[model samples]
Target: MTQQPDTLTESLSLALHYAANGWRVFPLLPGSKRPATPNHRAADCDRTDPWCRTGHAGWEQRATNRPDWITRAWSSNPAYGVGIACGPSRLVVVDLDTHKPGTEIPEPWHRFGITTGADVLDHLAGAHGGTITPTYTVRTVSGGTHLYYTAPDTTRRFTNTAGKIGWLIDTRAHGGYVAAPPTQIGSSSYDVTDDRPPAPLPMFLLDLLSRDQRPTPSTPNDDHNAPQRPSSRPYRPAGCGDPVHSTSAYVEAVIAAETAALNAAPDGGRNLALWVMATNVGKLINRGLITEHAALDRVLAAAAGHIAADAYDTYQAEATIRSGFHRAATKPTTSTRSAA
Candidate 1:
C-alpha cells in the first residue's frame, strides 16, 4: 500500500490545490474525520483567539479558500487531513461505501441484487432511466467511490444525508464535509481517480432531492406509490407477531417517545428531529423487533402533525425515513433488549 507523506510539504501542497479550485478547506485530525481545530461549545467560548474574536467559528465557518490560511494551518500540523466544506464549496459529493464483512445487504436493495453503494446508485440511475455520468470522482481508502457534482445555484441547499439517494449511498452537501485527496488515515490515503471538474447534478437526481426538502400534506402515503402500511392484520403488541422473531416492550415505548418528540419538535428544527427519530426507529428495525413497514407507518403518523402544521412535505419525510432506516441497517448498532 502507498504510505502517507512523512512530512508537511505534501499536505500543504494539496491544501493549496483545493483552495485554488475554490473549495473551502479545513483541517481534519490526522487519521480521522474529526476536525483538527478545537471545537468549543459556544457557551464555553472565551473569545480568546481570532477564530472566536466576534463569535465562535466552527469548522464550516472557519473553512476557507484563502491560501495563507491553508498554508498556515497545514504547516503547523503535517498529518492534518484536508476537509472540504461542501456548502461553501458548492459541491455535492455522493459517497458510495462498500459493505462490511459478514453483513447482508438490506431489504429492497438486496432484493434487487445491490451490494455496494455504487451498485445502489447505478440501480437508482437505471430506475430513473439514466446512467451514471462521468464527474470528478475519488477512490476512498476502503475501496469506495465519491462522485462530486456541482450544486445548483438555487435557494435549495442539500444537506448531509445517509441513504437519502439509496442504500449504501450518503451525501455531503450543506453543513457537511469530505476528506480531500492525498489525506491519509493510517495505512490508506484518499486518492483522486478522476481529475475532471464536477458535472452539474443530474436533473432527475435533483428532483428526487428537491422532493425531500419540500413540505407536504398530512397523509398515510408520502408519495403516490409509497408502500402502504400492512392492513392484513390489526396492530400487535411488541414481540407478538409471527414475522417478528422477538419482542421488547422497551422497543415499543422508545418508538412511542421518539415519535412524540418528532411531532413536538419546533418548526425550524423539525426536519433534523424527524431524521433522528427515524434513525432511532430504524435501530429497532435493525434488531428485528419491529418490521420496516411498521416503523415507517409510525414515523409518518408522527410527522403528520408537522405536515398539517406546514412544517415539511410528505416526500421529504419519506425520503428522510428511508434514508435513516437504511443507514441503521447498513451500520447496525449493538443493542441490548434491557436498554431498548
Candidate 2:
C-alpha cells in the first residue's frame, strides 16, 4: 500500500525503521505528547511499564526496535506517533524548553540567564576532562534545542525527569522517552537541526544526574547499545597538541596578551608579545580549524586598526606579525597550557 507521507502511517513506518537501527520504538498519541500504550487512561499509567503485557502499563517493557514488536504495535493503532525509548538506544536527551508558564509561544532563553544550554554544556564538559565535539541537536518547532548525549552505563532504565539539572532543562533517559524528529504534535514537529550522532554523556554531567535518585530502573534489559567511541584528535603541529581548538576562551586569551604587549611595546617587549599571538594562532592553524594564511591576514588587518588607534607605524606592526610566525616555526612552546 502507498503510504501518505507525514501522516500517522508514515510516523509508524518510521518507528519500524528506527527499530531496524536498534532504537527502541513505541507509539504516542497523535498530535500530543502522551504515549499511546494500552491502559493509558489509568491514573498509574505514567508509572507503569507500557511494554510489558504482564503489567498494567508495560510500555517500557514492550518498547523495542525489533521489527516484530514494532509491527504489532503499529498494526493495532496506525495513528500512533513514534516514541523513542531512550535507554537502550544509549542516548540521553537534554531538552531546553523555551515556553513560559501557561503560554504557547517561546520565551527568550536569555531571560533565564541562559543563552544556549549546549554552550554551557561544552564548557562544563571541557572543565571535567571531557571532549566537546559535534553531536546531534534537535530543533523543536517551538524554537528550542534538544541536545543528545550518551546514556550512563546501567542495566535498568533511568526514569524521565525534568528541571533539577538546570533552568528550563529536562532529561529523557532510561524509563523516559523522547519524540523522534518528524514526530508531529499539533502544528509543531521535532526535527534534527544537527545531523551528527549523539556524544557520550560527560562524567561531570553524569555526576550531577546521580543526585536525582528518583525513578530508577526496575528491571534490566538484555540489550545495551554501547556506542563506539570516536576519537577527537586535533592536528598537533609537529608533535605538540594545540591548547585551544579555537575556542572562545582561547581567543580571549590571545587578545588580552596582544593588547597588553602593544601598550608596553615602548620598552621593546612588543616583539615577544606578537610572537605569543603567532604561536597561539599557529595552534589554530595546525588543528585545521583556521588557515595559516588567513591567520596572518587577520593579524595584519587587526594590526592596521591598532596602528591607527595607537599611532604606530605600519612597518612595526607588519614586522611584529612576521616575527611571530618565524618564532612559531622555530621555537614553539614546549609546555602547552591546560586545555581548559
Candidate 3:
C-alpha cells in the first residue's frame, strides 16, 4: 500500500496544503511540535525581516495563510513540521487523549470506568442526549484524536483549557495550536482520519466549554472588588468635561459595543462597519484611553467569523483597521471633538 506523505517534498506539500485551505499555519521544529520561529526581545530586533515588521511577533501573530510565507518557511528547513494556530483559523479543536500506563482515571470518571478522553467526551455527549458528531479529525502520534470544529460566531471568547469537559479531554481555541497531519516525532506521524470540513461546534459542547467563563454572582462584600460596570448612558468622547465617563470602563464599553456592531453588520456593509469600529477605537487610542494593540486585537477577533466565512481575509481586515486607525490618529485635534 502507498504510505502517507513522509519525505521532504511531502512535508513542504503538506504545509502548503494547510495554508491553501485558509488555516494560519506556522513552522514546527523538526521532529517536535515546538514552534520553530525564534523569539526576540524588542531591543534586539532590527525590524528588517518580514516577521519583525510591526514588532517582535510570536508564532501566533506570525502564523500565515499566505503561500509566499509558507513556501519560504518550509523551504528553509524541509524537516520542519506544521502547526495550526487555532484562533486565526477560526477553529475550536477538542483533543481526546488516551490514558498513559498506570494513570488512574480521575474522580467522577473512575467510578464509571472511563479510560480515554474519547470515553469522557462520549459520556459528556451522551449526557447531553447526543453523540459526538464527526468532523475533520486527526490522529495524533500517541493515539489521541483531534476533532476540529468551526467556532461559534458569538462575541464570547474561548482559549485553551485542560479537563474543561471531563477527565482527559481538553480544548484549543484562541491562544492554542495543534500539530497538523504528517508532522512527525520519532517514527510515528500525525495522520488524518476524517477529511471532512469542520462541523459547527455542537451547541451542547459550546455551552459546556463557555460555562466557566461566565461571571458568577457576587456577594455584598464583593462589590468593593468588582470591576466598574459600563454605564447604560450613551458614550461621550473624552475631554468633553465628563471625566467621570473617561475611565477604562468606558474604553472597554466602547470596544464591546463596536465589536457587537461589527459582528452584526450585513454583507454589503461589513467592511464599513469594521472601519468605523477601528476608527472609533482609534480615537480612544489618540486620547490615550486605549492601547492600539488592544483595539486591533479585539477588532480582528470580531471579524474572525466573517473572515472564516470568506467575507474577507485577515490581510484585508488588518489593512482596514490600520488605515482607519491612522486616519483618526492624524486628524486635527480641533476636529476630533465633534467628529465622534
Candidate 4:
C-alpha cells in the first residue's frame, strides 16, 4: 500500500524546505490586533477607518475595486498575516501578507520560489550578481534572519517570489509585500544574524543605486557674466525652436538645409550658435535656477562680439555718405542754374 501525505505535515515540510533552500516564508492569518494609542479610537476615527464607508470609497477609487481591500482594511483595522523570510544563510520573520496568487514575481526571484534561505542566497550570488550572507536571529514572535550584501548601485530594484504572492521585503515593495509591525496580534517577529559577511550586489543594481546620489542639472543663465544687448532690440536666438516632426531621414536632411543659409550669411551663422545657447539656457530657467533676465543677458553677450564688428563697418559706410552729401550741398546751386 502507498503511504498517504499529511496536509499539515506537507505545509510544515514545505515551509521548512524553503527555509533550508533560501526562500523567505511568511504565514497568513485571519485577524489580529496591534498596538494602539490611548486616544486611538474616537468618533472622528471613523473617517480613517479602512472599512468605513468614506474610507472604502477612497480605497475603491485607488485600487480599482480589487479584493485587495481585505489587506488594506487589515492594515488599518488590525494586524494579521504573520510570516517569516528565510534565504540562504539568513532569515527574518515578521507580521505581513505575501503577494496574492497570480501576482508576477520579480525577474530576480522568478526562477526561485519557496526555497530554503540558503538556496535563495546562493542564487542571488550566482545569478543576480551578489553574495548575501545569512544573518539569523529571534524576534518576539518568531525566528528569522537578515541577508546583507552591498549593491553595486542603488538604481536597481528587486522583486522575488514572496512579493509575487503579496509579500514584502524591507518595506520597499520589491516583491509586492509590506512589512507589518510586531505589536499586532497574529503578527510574529523575527531575528537576523549573519555567519559571514555578504559580498557586494550586482553591478547593475549598484548602478541603479548610484543614480540616486547624482546631483540634478543646474538651472540656465543664472551667471552674472551674461552678455548685454541694445535697449530697443528684442533678443531672439537663431535657428532655435525647430520642431522635430518626423523620424524619416528626409526630415533630417531638411534640417541640415539650414547649414547652407548659415554659410551664405555670416551674421545668420553666428545667430544660429547663439540660438542653440539660448535654448539650453531656457531649459535651465524652467528648472528655476536662472531668472529670465539673466538668460537674456547671456544670449545678448554672446551676440555682442559679432554685432560689434558688423556695426563698425556700417558706421564707416554711413560716415562716408554723410561727408559726400555735405560737399554736394555746398556746390549744388550751380548745376540747377544751367538746367534752367
Per-residue lDDT of candidate 3, residues 1-340 (tens digit): 1134557688778877888878999999888999998656657888876778887778898899998888888888878889999988989999999888887665555555667898777755543334588899999899999999989888877899987566788999899999988777888888888899899998767756754232221112223553433323322233333333323544554555455456556666678767867776787788787667656666776676665555656678888889879877886242321232
Candidates 2 and 3 compared by lDDT, better number: 3
User: On lDDT, who's better, 1 or 3?
Assistant: 1
Tens digits of lDDT, candidate 2, 106-201: 222232243544544553444233454467887775777888887766774555667555445688887778887777777778887787767887
The pairs that clash in candidate 3 are: none
What lDDT tens digits, residue by residue, belong to model 4 across residues 245-284? 2222222221122121112234323444333333433443
By lDDT, who's the top model here? 1
Residue pairs clashing in model 1 are: 215-312, 215-313, 216-313, 239-247
Candidate 2 regions with alpha-carbon error over 4 angstroms = 1-4, 7-9, 41-53, 99-116, 126-131, 154-157, 211-340
User: Please, what is the TM-score per model?
Assistant: 0.62, 0.51, 0.59, 0.23
Clashes of each: 4, 13, 0, 55
lDDT of every predicted structure (CA atoms): 0.73, 0.57, 0.72, 0.33
Error of 1 at 80 (Å): 1.8
Ranking by TM-score: 1, 3, 2, 4
Candidate 4: C-alpha RMSD after superposition:
24.9
Weakest ten-residue segment in model 4 by summed lDDT: 253-262
Candidate 1 global lDDT: 0.73
